[model samples]
Target: SLSDRLQGTFDKLRGKGRLTEDDINSAMREIRMALLEADVNYRVVKTFVSACKEKCMTSEVLDSLTPAQNVVMIVLDQLTKLLGSTESKLVLAQNRTPNVIMLVGLQGSGKTTAAAKLAYLLKGQGHSPLLAACDTHRPAAADQLQTLGNEISVPVFRGDGKDAVAVARDSIQEAVDHLNDIVIVDTAGRLQVDEEMMQEAVDIKSAVKPDQILMVVDAMTGQDIVNVVREFAERVDFDGVIMSKLDGDARGGGALSVREVTGKPIKFVSMGEKPDSLEVFHPDRMAKRILGMGDVYGIIEQAQKVADEKQVEDAERMLLEGFTMDDYLGQLQQIRKMGGLQKMIGMLPGGERMLQQAGNQADESQLTKVESIIRSMTKEERKKPKKINGQRRKRIAAGSGHTVQDVNQVLKQWDQMNKMMGKMRQMTQVSPKGKKKG
Candidate 1:
């Protein structure tokens, strides 16, 4: 949406090899409005616009042959800088064997969920993490943490009922006893301005002396998040932020506004409720996304993490030999693991626009329907789909609860996919280090 908005604003400047103050003024006005509409803090937008305007005024930008491109470049560069130039890692201490991390946030901000997600992320990074339930204020908070811990196969350190401070202190020893190299403490969520809540967080910090105190804030809170972060920084003093409910936020620029406004980097974003949906926040990738360039690197990285090596190799082998309905079903499962179709599209350039073009056809639910259709077929039918005549096609349509045309559509799609995979397999076999082998 930001890209579309900017496109109209920059249309006038497109042919101009050199930009005057009026051109810069028109562009900055649109940019400023776009950022504000995206829920970025007002002061942040003002500063960002001013910085971009200053760069446009430079002689080099004025003389550049591709002045319009240069203007876009300036915006991207400023956005990346505003978001924090480099990826911010959750700071861990080398001297400490079990790095303790305390998660703090307001009520319903997803602190408990973020803890498990972070553990899942850290476990993937080769660290054995233990979840510590230190949120005694809420009912059954310990049980909730234990459930999440079970889901991730991470150990939980739950102290005897209603002693959050004791839990915080005891979890350290539990980490040592279990040989968990990291401890993620889920603290009770509270309002930033609440004195009682602030004191409790302070007490726990004093007791555990955590390596990192990350505030898990709801990204959709917009400018309210800025005030909350400022309040927490003044009192509890968090090291970084973990933006939760990120995927649901339509106007996410406010979350990005925190880094510039509060001098704290956003270390992670909880994109979805799934344990594996947490991603390390990369500013450049986010900037690219806002500019409609897509986050191809992040998408590929996610694919690498979830892609089963053996399954993929087997699929490739099958593609070279012959593809079956079973192979097609397996590929569908793999795409689900890679965060479904919409996510895949979001990671590619012009993906949102493409989704708009696709209407309802590219909906993630289609994967389910396709999988159902494949499953409705018998094993013999799955292996040799060509053998299925009119009668069997009707039976599969009945079984999958779809129209006969749907079954035909699925068959057609599989046929096309099989051909494409065959081509890919041939290319890979013939190519030698990206060159065709003679």
Candidate 2:
């Protein structure tokens, strides 16, 4: 919503050839209101808007041929700076055999999930990571961590009835015994900030002497995050932040406020519920997304991670000879692997507007239905869709547990996709004169 609001303001400015001081001030008013409504800390919003206003009023910006573009760039720069100009990586100790990363935050902040996601991320990076269940106060907290660890195939070290501090200290020993290179301790949190929670976090920190203490703040916490983080910073002196639930329907004020208010860089953000949904935070990429410029590089990085030999080969073939149902299924699977079409679309320029226009079209359930329909088809029918006549459609629909109309919809979509691919194939074809055909 902040992205949409800011983009709308900028679109108005971009439509103008020349902007007076009044226009700049008007846009600033809109931006200030947008930030406030987004739940950004009031002081931070004021400072940010003031800085942008000063920069935009400079002669260099006001007298520029593309004044509106310059103004947008200024805002981007300021936003990036506000978001901690650079990416802060989760640094592990190279000399230490088992680098300990302790997660601290309020209860319901998704600390347990963040622990598993961090372990999953580190394990994927070729490190042996062991999870430590240190949240002794909450019922089933250790069980939740263990369940997540099992899902990620990482080992979990529980202290049973031991205190949080003892569990943390022992988890390091467990890592050493098993030759685990890292240990992530999921520390206990309270329903709200209190001396008890802070004391427990300090005790755990002192016991394990973690290389990094990541404060896991819920992204939807809004301005309340400032006070929570301040208390945590004063007590545990955390190294960085792990923002969870960033993909929620919140205004994202907490995300914007944390770095500026606490002076701690955000090391990672949990975009979705999946274990692999944890992504290293990049301020510039985030700034681009907020401005509706999108994160093209992020999309490419995600694609490269999931793209495989077969996927690439299928793509090449699709361009040359159109795609079959099997190919479509493969592509859909690939999209799912890359966090679904909604995520991919969100990282595209103007994606926010496009999503607003195409409500529910980016829904993942639709993709699932299409997958089921394609799978219900015979192998021959998948390869040669033309073989699916009325009778076959009825059978395929019955098999997939859908009406024949759903099958016909899938076939119609396939036809549309093939027509587009045909156009692409023709365009990519080389002529005898050594030029590509149009």
Best model per lDDT: 2
What TM-score number comes out for model 2? 0.79
lDDT of 1 by residue, 1-438 (tens): 665566456556776667887888888999899888877889999999999999998878877887887887788789889989888988899999799999998988999999999999999999999999999987788899899889889999887858889989999998899899999999997654588888999999999999999998887786787888888889999899998886763535766689988899999988888898888888887776776555645644555567765654554455457689998887678768765677765554445655565573765688888999999999999998888889999999999999789898888767765664553343223222232111
lDDT of 2 by residue, 242-349 (tens): 989978766357888889988999999998889989999989888877776666457546656778655544555664677899887876787888766887766655
Backbone collision count in every prediction? 0, 0
> Local error of candidate 1 at 55, Å?
0.8
CA lDDT, every model vs. true structure: 0.80, 0.84
Using all chains and alpha carbons, the TM-scores for the candidates as numbered come to 0.76, 0.79
- The regions of model 2 sitting more than 4 angstroms off are 308-339, 364-438
